[model samples]
Target: MAALTPDTVDIIDPDLYVRRGYPHDEWAVLRREAPIYRYERANTDPFWAITRHADIVNVSRQPELFHSIQRLFVTINEEGSPAPDEAILRQLLNMNPPEHGAYRAIVNRRFTPRGVQGLREQIDRITAEVLDGIVDRTECDFVTEVAARLPLAVIAEMFGIPRADWAMMFRLSNMMIGPGDAEYAGDETILETLQRARMEFFQYFSQLCEDRRQNPRDDLASVLANGLVNGAPLPIFELMSYFALLIIAGNETTRNATSGGLQAFIENPAQWARLKGDPSMAAGAAEEIVRWTSPVIQFTRKATADTNLCGVPIRAGDELALFYPSANRDEAVFDRPGVFDIGRNPNRHIAYGIGEHFCLGANLARLELQVMFRQLAERLESVESAGPLHRMRSNFVGGIKHMPIRYRMRPRA
Candidate 1:
């Protein structure tokens, strides 16, 4: 590939993402030459690409300076503004400051280390069961079978959703998050698919909300339904967005991280050997996997006022794309950014992001990854790819749509 200039590189294009996994070559160029490169492309809204770790941290930390509400994300194909309904759906991801805190407080306790710790036995059971399904098989699609199962079951159980409805949650999340991929995009436009997904979730959750209200259960859905935000019930739209965000955020990121982490181990057998040798390294390995995968690819933040980032000028409304993957790989931060080291010490990758709007599900995600990988390390004897890897055609979420692997594992003990 020719050396890409800021004028030539189009990082937001989903097609480019599908053809080539991340544009690290392009990111490296920008990181070296222009850490805060202004990205301008036709049709798509122009924004500054913050590639370096320091700059990303600075921008992410100062949410007041760079607002999250102006625009929640960067779109690959921007035909026009966000749909009318999309504007009304407010969640922690798009909220800023006091409001973000208040909303997050609703379930914050439930996701803290202590809160998530309560689910350890549950997570372990789910992991063992998932691994058990693959123990007798010589080959399986790790993405769909192994990686996707734990998170889906865990989140559904938390919401008090029936086992039958878990598949709907999975389908809705895929359509909403991976609509750029042909597998889920179908005949509708991306925006259309997204809008339809929101409607379906609203319809489903609306009933769940009503049921939970009348017949309250000790579940997250009941909590949200009866919970108050600022001394009042959560508006229908916010309630729906909360459910959607949790289901997607909890499911998608962890699923991709597990699948991608396994791929990393396969390519770096030394790391795999080290992990298998010491299952205690599972916690550090989980952190490394999150850093390596950087599942939530990029989120857009607009400048609330005229402010400069890393010596780059910005107008009040100028948006900046915080490229998490690039930051995770910045040479300034990690000793060997490219190496997949499971036992990397002092790992401070901001895959969950930084500051005010950091992922609310961070603790839960960490717990899930740790349990899954630890179980695999102890039980999975040998593993290798069985077929080509198929990745989602999505630049937003770094997703592994399908990963076939032939592996040996000990049966549940």
Candidate 2:
């Protein structure tokens, strides 16, 4: 393969992601040769690419220095789109600490480890129901048949959405984040697909919000619809953006992680067998899978003030893209980083990221992965890749889009 050059390291190019898996080799080069690399493209802004794990951590920890409030999250190319409230994206994805903390606190308790663990039986039930759909099949596309359904079910239930609408939500999420992919967008440009999806999302969620207000339930949607932020009920746009984030972010991250995690198990039979023997290893297994997948590819931050990162000078307002996939594979952090290990100890992967902006749904996502994999380890007789694996042609949120897996399954308990 030819060496990746400056022109090819944008990290947000959808073509590169479709052709290469996670851009590992290119990131390795960046980490060792130029950890704070820079890249520029046509009609796009030039920004510093933060590749090394430590650099990502440093930037994340100091949110005051690297602010997300500058009207962007990771990529400027996809910024400034039509939505319910065009400005709400900033409030949701780019809020500063004081404000970010307030909104995050609205429903934070429901996503904590304790809160998430409380739903283990429910998660297990959801997993079981989804698995039952595929139990009799000799071969299936695990991507859609199994992995995609689990997160949609869990999150839909959380949002108090009707079961009938879960599939719609999942489809809208794909169209929202995957405009660059033919499977999702077909011929639509990024902004066009995103705007179209946003309209659908706004139309549906707007009704749901009103319904929740009239008939509140013990769900996240009801909470957000009725809840107040800073002595004021969330503005309509903020409310809509919150729902949009939940639908898109909530679905894509976990969905991709599950799909990619299953592929990992099939690829590393020994690791799969290890888990089969000891289901308790599901904890470490979750971290390893998230590390391996790193579905939420890159998170960006804008410099609030001039500073230096690992001796590299940075200017105020400069965007820094944190390549989470690369950080997870940093050789300095994990032993044999390239190899997949279900039982890797001290696996300090920054997959969910660090600092205040760390993934709020991390606990829930971890629990979902653990429960699903544990069930597989118990009931799965054997499994392996059965055909060519296809990935979502999306650069931001991506994973196996079509994976044919041949597997034998034992009767469910």
Candidate 3:
């Protein structure tokens, strides 16, 4: 890998993510040379990129100092902080301890190991059905046909959303995270695109909530609609934002991870073969894939008071981007960081994030990935890139969006 120069320091550029799947070598330099390097582009306040594993842990641990409410996206300081009246980030993100904990607890039980374990049979059924859709075809866009399908279904079924609406849910989720991409944004500004998606999401979910209230079901939607926090009903807007986050955030991360996982197997066939040789390795392989692919690239944190992180200077109101992809590969934490070993041990990857805001769906995602590779190891005969792989032009949900794969698979039993 070439040295990163001043000409190449614009790591936040969305184009860079699309070009290299990620700026891995560049990030490697940051992790090695400057774990907390301040990054700046034109017309915006600079932010420290927290590239090392330890530094990220420190930041995540002190959520009170590094707030999550004012900014959930990387464009936080750039787009201006989410205002009190207009910003629902407080609901989806930008939260402090007690508020964050109570809100997160609503669905926390369902995503626990014991909770997600109950869904294993359903997950297997969905995985088998999704794979079955692509098995007969000699070629398919693995992203749309397979990787993107199961998570959408899992979340929709959890919400009691009808199967017929999964496609719309998928499209809407992309619009929420993929506004910077030309395919989703068109001529609109990113804010405009996000706002538009939120508006549509709000309208649809409001009706969904109303129905759940009138005719409750034993599902996540009903739980949320009727859910109580401090013995009071959740505020309407906040509840709506939670619904939006569950659909968009919950759906996108797993979907992108599954796609990125397959891409990893294709690139590192030895790992694929290793998994094929032993289906039981699926559990560890799934973590390696998440660590390797890092579907959610960046999340923002803001400083509430003066602080020094890993011997670096800091100040109140300072903003930082926790580059999860880079942190997952920190040489200090991961031995032979560049290698992709399916059985890599002590895999403390933060792909699902860490600390207070650790991804609520982490257990579910792990199960989904484990199940996916297990079946693939057992059934997939061969898989390779059929055409040029294309990544989503996103700085947020880093993913391979157009993965055309040529493959053969045994029929589902």
Candidate 4:
């Protein structure tokens, strides 16, 4: 094959991905033309967009060769720069082997099946309360009223924070993830908004840390406040970074997944009927929803050394964009790739990513979704779209921002 150039390969566009209106059509063309494609834009680092499932697995499995410790996204600033701050760079998702292993080990216990299982009653009660508040309304913004608040409350409980702070945290998390979204725009640019959010998050967590240190509780924050990592209390910055990750990863991603799943169901009423007819299908439906939505659309990995991926040559400094959405829709992996079916067996999707960097909160997210869907199916007698849905303008972590839905409650059994 001829050496691939930027012109020949369809440069993966961040704006198109952000809009997420018709991404699969573009992805289909890219997958066939250039499975290992190079994307270059005006204000971002040039990267190889890995679109195939096999290639994504290959890249993720070899973390040393395809490092995640470097630039984590495709977009940059007005000056065309990559990630530049070391203090901000040392989080678990951005660290390599031995360090990543050690750091991940510290909190791995908290996210295990048993650990999450312990929170089942709390999660069920929380889900019930959320649904109770809105089940009677004829129409409501599902994003704000249900999807957004549920996960925020869950995380607040986990961190022992006030539920009233959800709105502020939600806004900060949006600014943190909304790369090019206009809602987060202000006199300060996107980068400034991100910086400000980080600072505010750090400050808030710092105060929480002080409280936890003085009067520890049973929550994760209390554990981190006094627990020893590498025989010393976790550093304040590192603790804060973990808190930030929990807020973004724990709160926003799940919220997006829930809302996006509901939107998917609304779009495909047959699938909704399948889920409603047999609530046993809730678990399978949840998987299908995540597969369809692919909430964390893409994550970045840096090349540690010269490598050849899917027969495409990559240099030492090259970056790889692991397109999770593309991988979930890979024809080689799933039959009738475009069809949305809750009955997909052996659905080994990379929505939660793979390897050591796999989302620690995956089990919690799964539990939350499963319970939410089950409850929604049981409580919602009839549900339909009341108006047009609005999606967040973000290339990464894409989902419906606003979904107006008219719903009626099912009579109590």
Q: Which candidate should be chosen as best, given lDDT against the real structure?
A: 1
TM-score of each: 0.97, 0.94, 0.95, 0.93
Encode model 3's per-residue lDDT on 282-369: one tens digit a residue: 9999999899888888888889899898778899987889999988988889998889898899998998888888888888889988
lDDT of 2 by residue, 85-140 (tens): 24524444678878899998888888898888888888999999988888888898
- Candidate models: Cα lDDT each: 0.87, 0.83, 0.83, 0.80
- The residue pairs found clashing in candidate 2 are none
Q: Which stretches of candidate 3 lie over 4 Å from their true place?
A: 5-8, 75-89
RMSD of 1: 1.6
lDDT of candidate 1 at residue 177, scale 0 to 100: 88
lDDT for 400 in candidate 3 is: 69
Better of 1 and 3 by lDDT: 1
Candidate 3 weakest lDDT stretch, 10 residues:
76-85
Write model 4 residue lDDT over 1-413, tens digit each, in one string.
66544344333444665444546766776777788888776655678888889889888999889888544666544432224443442478788887788778777788898889988898889888888888667999999899987788888889898877777788888877774577774566666677788898888889988999999998988877776777887777778887888877788989988998888888899988888899889888888888888898788888889879877889998888888988999999999889889999989888999887888999899989998999898888888899987877666677567889998976434
lDDT comparison, 3 vs 4, better candidate: 3
- Residue-level lDDT of model 1, residues 194-276, one tens digit each, is 77888999999999999999999889999899989999999888899998989888798899999999999999999999999
Off by over 4 Å in 4: 1-14, 18-22, 76-89, 411-413
- Arranged by TM-score with the best first, the candidates are 1, 3, 2, 4
